[model samples]
Target: MLNSIGIPGLIIILVIILIIFGPSKLPKLGRSIGESLKNFKDSTKDVIIDEEDEKKEQKQ
Candidate 1:
């Protein structure tokens, strides 16, 4: 989905977000988004690991 956006589209979106959020709040917003993504990634990794372990146990 995002593959179609390209750099210009991304820049436009960022500009819109900046206008809406303002420079003062941008850092906080970015930090929040980063933490959310990190948590999501960690959970995804845990799920994959659990699935792999389950598959190994089933084979054994």
Candidate 2:
């Protein structure tokens, strides 16, 4: 779904966010989003490793 949104679309969306949230709050919002994504990535990596370990145990 995001793939369909090209550079122009992204720029428009960003502009909208800027208008809605204003410049002062944008930094805080961006930081929170970054942290959320980082946590999500770490959790997904752990899940993948656990699945691989389970598969290895089954094979043995």
Candidate 3:
């Protein structure tokens, strides 16, 4: 869905968000989002490793 937005569409969306959130809030929002994404990525990696370990044990 987002892939269809293209560069111009992204620029427009960013501008709208900037207008709504203002500059001061943008940094905080970005930092929070970054942290959330990082945590999600780490959790997913842990889940994948656990699944692989289970499979290995089952094959033994």
Candidate 4:
């Protein structure tokens, strides 16, 4: 679904976000989003490692 948005669509979305949040808040919002994504990725990686360990244990 997101693939179809293209560059123009992204620009429009960013413009709307900027209008709503303003330039000063944009950096803060971006930082929060980045942190959220990082946490999500770390959690997923941990889950994957746990699953792999369980699979290895089952194979023994």
> How accurate locally, in lDDT, is each candidate?
0.99, 1.00, 0.98, 0.99
lDDT of 4 by residue, 1-60 (tens): 999999999999999999999999999999999999999999999999999999999999
- Ordered from best to worst TM-score, the candidate numbers read 4, 3, 1, 2
Superposed by TM-score, candidate 1 places the C-alpha of residue 17 at a distance from the truth, in angstroms, of 0.5
- Cα error of candidate 1 at position 29, Å: 0.5
Clashes of 3: 0
Q: Please give the lDDT score for candidate 2.
A: 1.00
Error of 1 at 46 (Å): 0.4
Cα TM-score per model: 0.89, 0.86, 0.93, 0.95
The collision pairs in model 4 are none
| Model 3: per-residue Cα lDDT over 1-60, one tens digit each | 988999999999999999999999999999999999999999999999999999999999
Question: For all candidates, what are the clash counts?
Answer: 0, 0, 0, 0
- Residue-by-residue lDDT tens digits, candidate 1, 1-60: 999999999999999999999999999999999999999999999999999999999999
lDDT measured at residue 55 in model 4 versus the true structure, 0 to 100: 100
> What is candidate 1's CA lDDT for residue 14?
98
lDDT of 3 at 42: 100
TM-score-superior candidate, 1 or 3: 3
Number of clashing residue pairs, candidate 4: 0
Give the residue spans of candidate 2 off by over 4 A.
none
